[model samples]
Target chain A: MALDRKIAYINLSTGEIRKGDIPLEWRKKFIGGRGLDAYLLYTNNPPGIDAFDPENRVLISAGIVVGALASASARTHIMSKSPLTNFLGSANMGGWFAPEMRWAGFDHLVISGKAEKPVYLWIHNGEIEIRDAKNIWGENIYDTQTILRQELNDNEIQTLCIGPAGENLVRFANVMTGRKNAGGRTGMGAVLGSKNLKAVVCRGTMDIKIKYPEEALKYNEELINQIISSKVSQTMQRWGTMFIYGTTNSTGLVRTRNFQLNQLVGGSDIECENLDKVSIGLDGCFGCQVHCRHRYVIKDGPYAGTYAQGPEYTSQGAFGAEVGCNNMNTILVGNHLVNSYGLDTLETGSMMAWAMELYEKGILTDRDTDGLRLEWGDDEAVLELIKKIATREGIGDILADGPLRAAKKIGKGSETYLVHVKGMSNLHSDERPTPSLALGIATASRGSDHLRSRPAIDLYNLPVQVLEKVYRQPDGYDGPLTSGYTKYEGKPRIVLWQELCYMAVDCTGMCKYHTVFLSPNHPNFPEFAKMIYYNTGLEFTPKEIWDIANRCYTIERLFNIREGLTRKDDWLVDRYFDEPTKRGLPVAYNKKMDRKKFKAMIDEYYSLHKWDNDGVPTPELLKDLDIADLYPEESRQERKGK
Target chain B: MKIKKVMEGARDGEIRCLACFTRFRPKRGVDRAACPSCGVQWRISWPYPKTARLQGPVWETYPKPGEPIAKK
Candidate 1:
């Protein structure tokens, strides 16, 4: 029989370490990885504390099936109070780190307090040591990892660290591993930097036994075949998500020039096919068969000889469509810059695009940007802005604190031009034409993020029968439904169901690409049930798994609610209602999201979750989920002391 | 727009119909897959290895620069 991994409590101020096993009851209720991390976060803090406070914690964990032979089960979920949102800062990344963490014999680490000096954690084969890391503290992300591997004298060591962006407390800094796998949203790296922690280096050879190896192998083979058989997966393997440009840009689903247009005309220069000229090969996370990441090198022109992995579809929007630059080199160089500096590529692009919009409207003068004209298609300026934001120099310093704060600093109704939800900027897609996607980003737990609950398949024009079969079960939605991507009909039901599906997927550490992010027939609850039962001998029926996901999502809601976010926070920018999409085919063109119907949808979604119209989880719902004691004793005491 | 075909795991020869999701291998030198379910014509472009990437749900409706294609 396989044994469970323990959680380590490390206090940096006192340098005290305590270790204990996660309660089996919590595992049954919340599962592991992101779900358990969210639970721990809610119970640890009293709410409304500064994200940079020494008492704020940084929780890192491997999912329940991580390091198992299962494919794509290697997401490392990082959670902290977001300096960006000040509401539930949580992020996940795909890499080799979590599997190594699992082998190091700890499922989770709850890090607290600030260090007196810069340090890093060395965890190996069930033991941990806080070592002085002054040598690598201010290094860029790649060089920091390189230094750690060199210092440890082992190439096999995996490192998760921040760069100068994080060290400078940039609000959207990424905590990254490898060249590209980033815990990319919500500035969790800044949280680590605030504690004077540079990195966590791990090398593990501990045994992780499988309870039912033969059954697991057979089932995993079937699962892998199911994933690889999809046409979307095949496209992913070929062009990465850059293949999405073929549909999104052509159909005007993309955001161009900071939401002024739906698509960029004559921007085919940055197309995925063009990138093949520089392509070396495919790269991917541990044990993933999809191989959906591109490894490319710039071999000519301005960025000659620069090599890196990726410039995902998000990068296309960031540097290409959104900021109005149509050059591939911009993406290549911009991707390299953000990856090295540990900045979130999406947020960097959003800030640049927003600033361009401000400049276009004359709300921002040349003096505000320090005489550097913020113009569309100025690829040089976009690349320069990325560095400035990371290093907190001039205008970069203004955007480094993120859109909401930067808007307040810039004033003159800059907030109205900002595209964000819960103070975090939305992705590069213009969701004005797609109500389902709009609803997902509007109410995402981590603030305008796509990975949380995006139904990427919704715009596939999937047959109504297919949509009904996929989304209308697991608590069967009988509301009005349609196949039209632009319709506001029955979207709340679909969005709610997808929320649970993605929550469970994160809990099990499966990539959304392997699940229902694409394809109507992809794996769901019953598949997760067999996965848990076969691998860990945890017997959960499909319904039980759904209930577990419900519990996990509700806990995240409790955390954000305690942090003072209300139903109004679960809403989109006014642009969705005010401006119609200016490009794409007839189905997408001139379409604006219906405000009244959207509000009604929100009400319906809250009712479905058994919450009041305000989107907070009800007491009855919390009690039903077995997390009735939502806060800890310390939280109550903190409020009393206040 | 031209596409070069190469052998990859999922793109050996077969292409899936965007409308019906019915997958069928083409005859020698056949360049398209007409859906038997919805009677929609899908242009096949084997642009890269590992993907016989379908152009769109309705490829004929693919635009001609800053304008949606005129479609019935």
Candidate 2:
């Protein structure tokens, strides 16, 4: 079984649908899922198209091992040119939607052209239909899903939909499913909005015939057991990803009050243990064991009656700490509002916090915000802003364009207040003190993002032996690896290693929690190779997996390069370098990211990728990866009409 | 995610490192306990509000997973 899943090309303007089996060469080269998606997007999209242009294609794909008996193989990846960053717009989310899509006889979807009217795609056992979504237009995320379920009469179907934030074309708006699961960064939802497409409904009874069912079951059980055995998994199982706040906050490694502070002062209200007051237990996506998502109910407050699924550590950083709110209710309520409206919690919170800072500095006056005081921890103002941004009402309309665009419109040196990389907001976790994590976010293809390659375990100060073992992949780099979180020595190698490992993990559609994200002892290339081979009867060595990951990540880099990103764009903001951290552990306290060392680290990182100092992939490297023709001189000239 | 603070070390209770989650017995008047797993020295406030807070890591003593703990 070579996993020849079907990729569908749907044109909304002309009501035409095309389906075909993905070529085996592409499958072997790209490894399906996000890997395939990168290839599809890079090949299908011509450069210079506006993000909202009808030709800007949107792709949704599932990883190779998704339908197989695999560990946490329930992620779906979506990609298009970002309205916010205007570079490579890609987002991955954990949910059963991808698995349902696999069972519905497709692994990838290429949606092109805008519909004349609002509509949704309904895919059943081997059938695709374009259904009118006139009745559900402008519905919020929760309402849209509920309406689709009512119409389809299927409780088990999965729906990926957008809300008013997306329909209004909020630059950082996102797609949401299962209440909390969001393809949450880089404005994937706005792409759907531009197309007049509302939702993608999937339900099917098609069997996913495995090549070696018994061996796959045996190996998958072992893999699951190993995954559940990690201490990180134990903590995540109990407290969800909220547990990350424990060490990060105590160590003072978070972006507080819009990057004004290193740590949240008096922040126990948002600690992981405090979630117990609101949430009784956690939930999981399809076939996931770690269950790192919280479904909480607001116990008491104006928002007490509402319930929603997550306020992951991001929400805590977004609504709780970053906005200067020290109450759990504000975090829960804010989380609910963002999810309901299908907005990205990270970008939304970052925008709100940045605006609060601007208002505090007299940059945003009472006239701009309609006389509402943008005070810290003002629950009403915070909740009201979520509504405003989603509806594009008043000040929210300006903020909805995302920080970079909004900054371009407002010129009081306000752009300096933003804590973003490559025009996209970073996570709530401040990385000024952590060089590896800082480099990870600064160089992510989809702009400032953590999940793409954050070597989170680097903060754990694991032994250099462990670091050496982890960084020994993709290439046998016997360099000096350091476990110190603040050190720049060997950071380039670690970040590069994690990038490829993550690319492979994403290629397999496995959850990051199941891999060595938070835990150094979790699965890696060897385990992934075994998982794919045992499940699909596709023979692959760990080296092959690394090469495929390299190929995939390098192609992503190529995509961004073609979109006009240069070496200068592969760095963080001035605040990350200019302002020293005010609070944290002794090592991190009063520490600013050293520009010279970071520059050298970037140079070394480029060398590892065989990319030149300017961050261009060298011809030799491109030839080695067999992607030399991906962005040929002829294609570049053709685009320029030279 | 559990926080075990022996702040007022007034009555002896199980103390734990907020970083590595290692549970230990409160040492009499010992105001500090270094974690066996992550090796972060936590200040044990033996006051009205019992507290065991580990602020940073002692990297040299930090061990890899399943390795024997080096504790104080």
Candidate 3:
């Protein structure tokens, strides 16, 4: 079967739509979606281009595995030069959008140039149109989706749209699919808004073709069964990521009150039981049986009668623990507000926590808050401020730029309170003793995030005796009790390995949840490679997959470096280094990282990657990865020598 | 003189002398022989006591039906 390999490129200047077929060899080499998009971005690279420049292109691509016999949670990648990071930004999202795009007979959509007027792209099978969207241009995400559905007179169409936050060009604005699903990192929504594009409505009836249909069906069925029976899947199904709330809080790693404390006194109150009281049922994307998506109804509050699909683990932690507000109703309302208004929950929550701290310290007063008191537990005020942030009103106007930018604007000792690594707000997880996870966050391409590389299981499973034996420093000898959580020796190596593995998973359009289902202990790692091989007829071992992932990571790193990212950009907030948790017993407490030691570890990682000390790719490495022609020879040679 | 001879013979013979009612014939393929009058069974005189391996549930052991037997 000849699979549809067409990619649509829209030139905003002429409003000309060009449809081209991707070469068969390129498709085989790069796979599809993320890898292919990265290859395309590198080819279109222009020197000294700003992220918001008209020349900067945004490519939304669906994976080859999508819209076929793929498992649930197949993701779509939204790739562009990040307005926030000014580097190659690839944000992955899960919803019905990717499959819809595939069914429309297009592998990907490549958009460039700025539209002269407000417009939306209507993709109906092979026909494409740039329709006027002036009526819905400044609307919130919810209204835009509703209006677009009504305008098309087809409610079944999957829409990816932006809200006023994006229209106003909030640096952390997210591209929202439906009310609950968003491509929420790297400011891709801002890029869309800059193009004067309102939404992309995709609908089609084309069928996906698969190789070895019988074999693929059998493998998929077996894989689904394994996932449903896995321990982690059971926990996810039962609690929807809230199972970790109690564990994270107990372990003293749940970020609380702008990361000043690791453990919140009322953190345990946000567990599954509490959430279950308000939850209606479960929601999931197409083909997902393990519905980890939670649906909730707020019974009573200032923001009552509001229903939403989540306050997922991170969002719950962000709004509840981080702000010192343990009200489940408040978190639910916050979730609904952020989703409907189309804003990044982590960024909004982190900014609120920072503002609250500043207010308590008397650095920010009623004058700055526009008569609203910014208290630690002021749920009502926080919700209102979130609205403002979405609409860029009052204090929200200052905060819509994110904590890092907001801190720079409100300077006197406030920068210390802004917890971020890169311009992105840190996901609410303390990285005190789990230095490997912390290292992963610090070195993440997008920003301080947990999803980029999760090391929770690694930290949980490592024997305490093994850790104590590894890091035998006398000065930090707090006791055996601290061994489980402490950042001791051999952590950097673990972080580097996990990050590379996660990158591969991200590129493959596979759900990380399946990893737990298929094999808790290296669960079906080889089977996944086999599935890919059988489907694509491409011979790949597990080691080859790892190599491809490493190459992708290097390509992203090179992009960042060229965009002016340096070693200075790879460090966490000062509070994490300086402060000890006030509630915890003194066990490896007040631990600070030595810059020299961290640098040495980074150098070791670079050497392991066959890159230079400066974190650039060598010629030999790039050639091996099939990306040698992308970079100038002199730059590659310089990296090789280092 | 007869009683004294019987008693002396009973003590000497491995099977018993038939002169007294207490004396009995030795039973073949049986460990013990029964006395017809007293209803008591006694073993014939032997060099050592014959031992038999018991094949049933052990004392204080819980029994499960249909368990496989181990070959010794």
Which DockQ value does candidate 1 get?
0.16
Which pairs of residues collide in model 3?
A519-A523
Fnat per candidate: 0.13, 0.03, 0.00
Task: Put down candidate 2 lDDT per residue, A335-383, tens digits, no spaces.
Answer: 9999988899999999999999999999998999998788888878998
State which docking tier applies to candidate 1: incorrect
TM-score attained by chain A of model 1:
0.97
What TM-score, over all chains together, does every model reach? Answer: 0.92, 0.91, 0.83
Tens digit per residue, CA lDDT, model 1, A23-100: 888889888999998888888875689999998989999888888968799889899999999999998889899999
Determine the iRMS, in angstroms, of model 1: 9.4
What are the runs in model 1 whose C-alpha is more than 4 Å off? A476-480, A631-642, B1-44, B47-51, B54-72
Worst 10 residues of 1 chain B by lDDT: B1-10
Q: Score the docking of each candidate (DockQ).
A: 0.16, 0.07, 0.01
In terms of lDDT, the poorest run of 10 residues in model 3 chain A is: A472-481
The interface RMSD values of the models, given in order, are: 9.4, 13.9, 36.6
Model 3: residues with Cα > 4 Å off, grouped in runs? A463-485, A516-519, A522-525, A584-596, A636-642, B1-72
Q: After superposition, how far is residue A274 of candidate 2 from its true place, in Å?
A: 1.0
